[model samples]
Target: MKVLIITGGNIDDDFASSFLKKNHYDEIIAVDGGLAFADRSDLSITYLVGDFDTIDRTILEKYIHRPDICVHQFIPEKDYTDTDIAVKLALSLIKNHHSEENEEKVIHILGGTGSRLDHVLANLQMLKNILDEDVRGIIIDRNNIIEMIRGERVLKREEMTGTYVSLIPVTMELTGITLSGFKYPLENASSHFGESLMVSNELLEEEGRIFIKEGMAWMIISKD
Candidate 1:
């Protein structure tokens, strides 16, 4: 299914509402404070998952009585973040369920980045976990769209929404990296931690392509 996971993190109403309106989602899972965002944005949530720790009791009670919304409440002291649990559940649902459109299962994350740097990093790391399920996970904020990429990929310039595109090694050493259609293109370059060798690159023409022989990269496409 084409599922959108909303996490209890930093969310801008204008951005979230616009994005939610633009996408075609079969289901929207609200995690904790995400419920508030969803309510404020006037978006209907298919499932609600979290400890209810951050949500208002009155709002939670109202949703509890709604037959249309499936609620899963977890304990406050769990090891996994509410976002993590929601993602795993979404993966399972995607694997077992079919989508209206015959395409790959994908998850778009909303309200996942901001103030909490640790949560932001954890959410970024979760992108790989989501992708491992053969489901594409992308974190969309007002400034950027972050995606975890594996193997060879082509990003058409016209398909890009941001002004700058950066590639960061997700592995210890992402080797044999090649870039085309970018102002500062690279060929057979290797990037490792301790250095952001690949960042702030712009597309030179109608398309930008990336070829990775081994390992993975976190591709950040930003507007500002």
Candidate 2:
């Protein structure tokens, strides 16, 4: 089943509301202050996960009695962030509800990026932990969709929605990288940290692909 988790970040109300309306997922989970967005947008939130530190007690109290909502509150001193907890919960649910024959589970995180650089970086790094799992997670912001990658895979470019596709090496080096259907194609190119080797690359056709033979990379697809 498809799950969408909306967190509390810098989100444009109109855009977030519209996107939430368009995507009809199996479950919708709201994290902390994200509950306020869902309340304002009139969206039905299935689950609420977070520390409840940033949320207004009065507003949160209203939902406490709701039967459809499952609240998981954590201590502020915990090591993992609210988003991290939400991700783990989603993965657990997916594992319990679905079997091996089913399709791969998808977990989309909204409100993942904003002013807090530490939180943003932590969310980005969290993707790496789930890369090898059956669950697929992405951090979606107003302008970009970020995901972690390991081993070999193909990245297809979408038209208009995202103008630029870039790859940042998370480790020391990413080997045997091949780029196809892109303006600046690369075959077995070695990418390293502190390098602008893979930035502003555009799709030459309808789609573009990136193949990583080894190591890990963070793929950032952003709007112009």
Q: Point to the candidate with the largest lDDT.
A: 1
lDDT over C-alpha atoms for residue 73 of model 1: 88
- Flag regions of model 2 displaced more than 4 Å: 99-102, 152-160
Model 1: per-residue Cα lDDT over 1-224, one tens digit each: 68999888888888777777778888889999888888877778889999999898877786867899988888999999999999888888888895566586789999889888998999999999987887789999889999999888788976888899999888898888999988998999888865688899999989788998988889999986
Clashing residue pairs in candidate 1 (N, C-alpha, C atoms within 3 angstroms): none
lDDT of 2 by residue, 195-220 (tens): 78998887877766788888788888
Off by over 4 Å in 1: 99-102
The lDDT for every candidate, in the order shown, is 0.87, 0.82
Cα lDDT, model 1, residue 17: 78
The candidate that achieves the highest TM-score relative to the unseen native structure: 1
